[model samples]
Every structure is written in C-alpha cells, then in structure tokens.
Target: MKSILDTVARWLPGTPEIAMVLGSGLGAVVDEFTDLSVLPMSDIPGFPTISVSGHAGNILFGACSGKNVLAFQGRIHMYEGHSWTEASLPAHIAAECGARILLSTNAAGGINPLLDPGDLMLIRDLVVPFPLPRRWYVPDSPAPVARTGFTGFLIDQKLADDARDVAAESGLPLRQGTYAFVSGPTYETRAEIRFLRRSGADAVGMSTLPEILTARKCGLRTIAVSAITNVASTVPEILTHEDVKDQARLLLPRFSRLLREIISNL
Candidate 1:
C-alpha cells in the first residue's frame, strides 16, 4: 500500500493541503481548479475505478481558490458491489498524501421537510446503519458484537459556520443536518425514506461514510456538503438515476461556488 501511494505521488507530484472527493453529479466542481493535472483512476495503482453515471472517474491535482488541492472526480461506493474497505481506499490514500483537510461533496435526497431540491446542506454529523464488519465497527457489547455505533468525523463548528455564512451571502440555501448512509445502487422506497426521516436523518446517500471514517482515522480534518437533488417523500413520482443526474447538473454551479469560497476562506 505504501508503494502504491509512492506510485501515485510520482504521478501527481505534489503535497496538497486539501483533498476532496466529489460525489455523483458533483464532479463539475473540479473545473474550478487551475493548473489541473487529470489522472484517470485506472492509471493509479490501488485506486478504485468508478462506474456510476455522473462521476468523471479521475483524480485532479491543482490550485483551487488559492490552495493546493487534490480532488477526486468520483468515488467508489459499497452499494456499487464494492466492500466498505475498498470504498474507503481513496480517502486513506489522500491522507497518506499529506492532505491536512478532506472536503467531500455529494448529491443526496432531502429527507428533512425544511430541505428542498437544489439546497446545499452542510453535514455536521453522520449516522450509518449498523452490523458492519469488525474492522470498521466497534462493537458495543461485551459479547463482541459485530455491529458498531455511528462512526465518522464531525466537521469543525468554525468551518461549518464559515460554510453557512458563505452560502447565505451567495444566496444559496444552506442547511445543516445529520447525513445517513445506506448501501445502495437503488433509490429508497417511500416507506424507507419516511423511516429514515423519523430516525432523524436530513439527507440520505450511498457514499461518504466509509470515506469520512477513513479520513478521521488518518487524522484529517473533514467537512462535507450535500447538494439535495430531490425530496425523498412518498409523493408517487417516478424516481430514477436520470432525474438525480439532471438535478445535480442544475445545481452544479451553485455547489461549485459554495465550495470554492469555502476553500478560499480555509
């Protein structure tokens, strides 16, 4: 693994202060960087290739809003037939590459009534489903329970405040909430959405949790934002990947600007 990191370092050749993982329809945010060096995930040893729609499947190293950064154009997910450890590899590699901060962006379904499509929500905390592998989850019982409690890094309050203020000034609707992660290649059913909302989740997505936990383990400061692509209510409307992609495209610029300003201020 160290050798794999060494290989990527040879290709990218920089010590980035910040590392980012762009999710789903959010890959366009990478365009904000100058002097970008694009590296296909396949070209990087030990990196997972992304196959989902709306993800660019590349790694970028460059200057964004005056800071040296390494950005992933897409990410692997547990729901994509990959294990949680496999899904977390990129974030671990980013930390090893010397990133002081890990910033992630995703397109999620709004579960909170206050959240609407195109809203940008800053994730203050996360709650993941249990029964995870022992390597990732810390058992709660003396009987050596395989499942663990919720685990992920909480974004610093100061950074969260800065993000909220920036979004407000930019006229972007910014909300804060607990993000929930589900293993998914499928969209949630109306009943499932209702249950998650009742459980206190504001947004729901397939990726981010494993990556967040990995970044935390590696001592990287982490912050995440979700671009709400749709309201996950039991409204009987057709929900498809196409719709999610379309919504993400519509909200890309706003998401990009919010991230750009936040990075600059950091």
Candidate 2:
C-alpha cells in the first residue's frame, strides 16, 4: 500500500501552522473550527483502523481563531498493538503536511491529589517506562544523536509558557504537571498508580508519548494537555472507559475554548 503521507501530500488542504491531535473524547474540539474539511482516517490508504469509542477517527482541516490547523480527530495507540512509528503516524503526517507546531490533547486519570476530574493539566514533561529510540532530535540537525545523559524536559517548555499565558488571560483554571504514559487496555492497579505518583506523574494515560516524541523528532514544537477524566486512586475504585469519556465530554466546551485561543496566539 502507498504511504498516506504521499496521499496527504497530494491533497493537502491548507498551509497549517499547527497540527493538533484530539485524543479519546477530546476529538470534539474540531467542531469549533471555521472553514472545516473532514476526512475519515479509514479513507487514507494505509491508515489504521480505530477501535476505541469516543474517537471520531478523522482528519480535520480548518481554521481555529483564524489560524489554519491540521487536526486529527482521533489517534492510533501503542496499546492497540501498533508500533511506536504507527502510533505516532499522525505527528509524522502533520509535519509532512507543513505544520510547525503540534498541539495534542488527551483524557487522563489524575494521579496527583490536588487534581480532579474536569481539570485541564498542561503537560510539562513526560514519564515513560522504558527507553525510546535515539533517532529523534529535530529535523535537519546532524545525524540522530546517541542517547546521552540528556535528562532534560522532552515536551517543550516555551510552548507550555505560551499556553499558560492564554489560560491566565481566559480566566480558565489550568494545572501544570508531568504526565505518565503506559501501554494499556486496562486501568492501573493501585500499586501502579502509587508508582506513577511517586515518579512525578500528575496524570496517567495510554497514548500521547509516542506522538509527542515523533512530533519533536520531526522538528515540530509540541504542547500536550490532558483532560483529567478521573482520579487513579490508591484505593481500587472501579472506573470505566465510558466514565472517562463522559468526563471528557463534559469538559469539551471549556477545554475547546482554551485550546482555540492558545492556537490563535501560537
């Protein structure tokens, strides 16, 4: 099968400044865009199928606050048996389509005590369980550097600062913290939740890491946000994906507004 990069390249809709990934129930943000064009992910020749609920599984081209955007209304995941490259395909496509920034959003279980359902947490950094490939350092740099002792922030802080200004100006509450990425079709156990909180994760989710890493590798400045959909507690409280999606739905209008304004200024 031909790569969808070629397909997207041929029919690219706009010169988008940013590429946005809408995660889980977060996909509805594209509805706020003007001059929107929609393409189902299934229609992209080599694109993978989406099995998760609440993901609309489409690519959206539109303008948010007058800035042209290429937004993916859904995303692939490593938990879905996709490779790291496959999970991050949207990020790669966004760069190929001429986007300079990547803005990604997801629904996560709050790992921090102060965070609650319905809060929007800015991803200041990420914590993953294992090593990532060393080949990603921005585009057109020297050869991909070997993994050194570079224990710096992987997610861009400048972009995070931009979002902070936007949130403050909008009078919307925002939480800034670290996000933990895990491969899962299951929720975390109490021990797992404890481990993550200890490791500095304020929110936990199954997606976003691969996408963020890929976006950075392609020279796209990246910003990630999470809709804290539930609290991953030390107590074994039963939670469902449906519950997570419901909370994200409730957060949509407010989250959408904040995200739109941030995109305008970026």
lDDT of 2 by residue, 114-133 (tens): 99889999999888753433
RMSD of each candidate?
3.6, 3.9
* Model 2 pairs whose backbones collide: none
Clashes of each: 0, 0
Worst 10 residues of 1 by lDDT: 137-146
lDDT of each: 0.79, 0.82
TM-score of each: 0.89, 0.91
Model 1 Cα lDDT, one tens digit per residue, 1-266: 56667777888767899999998888888776889898888877766667788888888899999999999888887666665667776777788888988898888999999998888899988876434444433232221112334343456667788888887887877889989887676788888888888888999998887777767666888889998999988446878888988999998887888898889877
RMSD of 1: 3.6
Measured by lDDT, the strongest candidate is 2
